[model samples]
Structures are given as C-alpha cells and as structure tokens.
Target: MKYHVQVFVSLKPSILDPQGRTVERALSHLGHENVSGVRVGKLVEMVMEGERAAVEAQARALAETVLSNPVMESFRVEVRELAGA
Candidate 1:
C-alpha cells in the first residue's frame, strides 16, 4: 500500500516565532491589521510504500524524532491513502 504523509513542523506555543511576527508586521504594513498571532510552519509531504500501520507509525516517528525540534517545536502528522490506488 501507498500512503501520502504530511508533517507540519512549528514552534511550540510557549516559544516565540520571530518569522511569524515579522510576517504579521508586514501584513499590517500592507494594510491588513486584522491579522494577528500569525504563526509560520513547515509542511513536509511525501509518499511512502508500506503497510498502512507501518507507514503511519514511520511517519509519526519521523515527525517526532527527525522533523521537529523536541525542545522548542511540535509537529503534527497526517496520512491518507492515494485515491484510485
């Protein structure tokens, strides 16, 4: 089986996000003051071939140990089977 996996990596809420704050300031300068607390994150997308359970497990493991910084960042994993597979 094949699975589509997405890992979203972002700073933990307790941490400060300089890039997100920068973007928020930029947006306000562009006349969009309504935006607040804009947080930035990275999305890692990949397709892996494996059994469903293994794929999900691997994806989550990767997200936890590799894709994110355990001290200051958190991650979320999403998995889906490809359509028409």
Candidate 2:
C-alpha cells in the first residue's frame, strides 16, 4: 500500500530564527504590536509504499538524521493511507 507522509520541521525553541524574528519585527514596525509570536517551519510531503508503521518510522528517522538537524530543529511526521490506488 501507498502512504502519504507529511513532515514538519521547525527550529528548536533554544535556536534563533532570524527569518521569523525579522518578520515579527516587521509586523511590529507596521503597528501590529499585538503579534507577539512568530515561528518558521518547513513542510515536506512524499508518497511511499510500505506498512504504515514501518513507513512512518523510516520517514521520521530520515527527517531526524538527514533532512533535519536534531540539535537545532525538531520534526514531526504524519502518515495516512493513500486512496484510489
């Protein structure tokens, strides 16, 4: 079966996010003072064939060990069975 995996990677709380901070500053400078929090992340979607559990594990490992930096970022994976095939 085919599974669809969605991976979300975000900077760790302790890590500095220059892009997010810049955007936040811009927002405040634009008078949106109520906006106090900003975070930046990346989303990756892929289709693969395997058992749900195994695929999810593989995907998470790939994200943690290869696609993302564990010290500076965290990752989450979501898996769902594909339909119509």
Candidate 3:
C-alpha cells in the first residue's frame, strides 16, 4: 500500500525563533499590526509504500530523528492511504 504523509515541524514554545520574530516585525512595519506572535515552521509531504503500521512507524521515526531537532523543535505526522494506487 502507498501512503501520503505530511510532517509538520516547529520550534518548541520555550525556544526563541528569530526568523519568526523578523517576519512579524516586517509584517507590522508593512501595516499589518494585527499579526503578532508569529511562528514559522516547515511542512514536508512525501509518499511511501508499506503496510499501514509500518508506514506510520517509519514516518514517526523519520520525523523524530531526521526532520526535527529534539533539543528545540517538535513535530507531528499525518498519514493517509492513497487512492487508486
């Protein structure tokens, strides 16, 4: 079976994000004052072929060990079986 996976990686709240702060400052400067406390993160999408349980396990392992930094970042993984594949 083939699965579609989405991995969302973000900095832990305890960590300061300079890039997010910079973007928020830029937006405020551009007259978007309502935009505050902005956070920037990454979305990774991929397709993998495996059994349902194995695919989920692989996605979690990849997210924990490769896609995110354990010291400062966290991640969530979503998996869906592809249709007609």
Instruction: Evaluate residue 83 in candidate 3 and report its C-alpha lDDT on the 0 to 100 scale.
Output: 99
Q: For candidate 1, what is the lDDT?
A: 0.92
Instruction: Please write out the lDDT profile of model 3 over residues 59-80, one tens digit for every residue.
Output: 9999999999989999999999
Clashes of 2: 0
The CA-based lDDT of model 3 is what?
0.96
Ranking by TM-score: 3, 1, 2
In model 1, the runs with Cα more than 4 Å from the true position are: none
lDDT of 1 by residue, 1-85 (tens): 7788999999999999999999999999999978999999999999988999999999999998988888999999999998766
* lDDT (tens digit, per residue) of candidate 2 on 22-60: 999999999999997698899989998988788988998
The window of 10 residues in a row where model 2 has the poorest summed lDDT is 76-85
Model 3, C-alpha of 10: deviation from truth (Å): 0.1
Candidate 3 off by > 4 Å? none
Kindly report which residue stretches of model 2 are placed more than 4 angstroms away from their true locations once superposed: none
